[model samples]
Target: MNSDEELSPFNSFQFWRVPLPELDLSLLETEPSAGSYIAPSTKDLEAMET
Candidate 1:
């Protein structure tokens, strides 16, 4: 095997054997709370309009 292939995680069978953790995708489906939003300042809005 080439040096590149030896360095790659994909080349090892053990890499594929390890199972990934289950992710909670429900959080991604929900809308972010209004408090999380940062509204642009009036100066920034005026600059964008111009």
Candidate 2:
């Protein structure tokens, strides 16, 4: 997966898997990570090419 890509919400998950009988959508409202994404440059790629 690309670091710069924003992954879809539970790309491989289904809501039915949750065992809760009455889960609210508001409970899952949390901020995503603010970390900066760094894609390796050509120089770095070349160094590891061997």
Candidate 3:
């Protein structure tokens, strides 16, 4: 199959990673909250979440 024929489940820059640009401190109380992360694809997230 040709490149154009291939389906893209991602953005144009598929190689670029997902960005987590925001975080709220108010969400956490006295307890220490965990870190935040972003995934390039749902497939990656599913792999980790599972």
Candidate 4:
């Protein structure tokens, strides 16, 4: 059971059984600043629709 075998999606049971990394709760507590995020332009949105 190598790291590759553990991570392979074809081995569904083994893939899901692998333990997930710990999450940082501090990130969730922090407030998002204004203009921190950028949205896709209308031109990009139109291309996606097609």
For residue 33, model 2's alpha carbon misses the true position, in angstroms, by 9.8
Determine the C-alpha RMSD for candidate 2 after optimal superposition of all C-alphas.
Answer: 20.5
Clashing pairs in 2: none
Off by over 4 Å in 1: 1-16, 38-50
The TM-score that candidate 4 achieves is 0.28
Which parts of model 2 are misplaced by more than 4 Å?
A: 1-34
Q: Go through the candidates in order and give each one's C-alpha lDDT.
A: 0.81, 0.65, 0.66, 0.78
Q: Estimate each model's TM-score.
A: 0.33, 0.29, 0.24, 0.28
Which residue runs of candidate 4 sit more than 4 Å off their true CA positions? 1-16, 30-50
- Per-residue lDDT for 29 in model 3? 67
Could you tell me how far off, in angstroms, the CA of residue 40 lies in candidate 3 after the best superposition? 39
The TM-score of candidate 2 is 0.29
Query: Which lDDT tens digits does candidate 1 get at residues 1-50?
Result: 56986778876888778788999887675677777876899999999999
- Backbone Cα, N, C clashes tallied per candidate: 0, 0, 0, 0
C-alpha displacement of 9 in model 3, angstroms? 22
lDDT of 2 by residue, 1-50 (tens): 54533544445467336675876877575754467456899999999997
Instruction: Select the stronger candidate by TM-score from 2 and 3.
Output: 2
Best-performing candidate as measured by TM-score: 1
Q: Every model's Cα RMSD, please?
A: 8.0, 20.5, 18.2, 11.9
Q: List the residue pairs that clash in candidate 3.
A: none
1-50 in candidate 4: lDDT tens per residue? 57986667866886568698999987775677685776889999999999
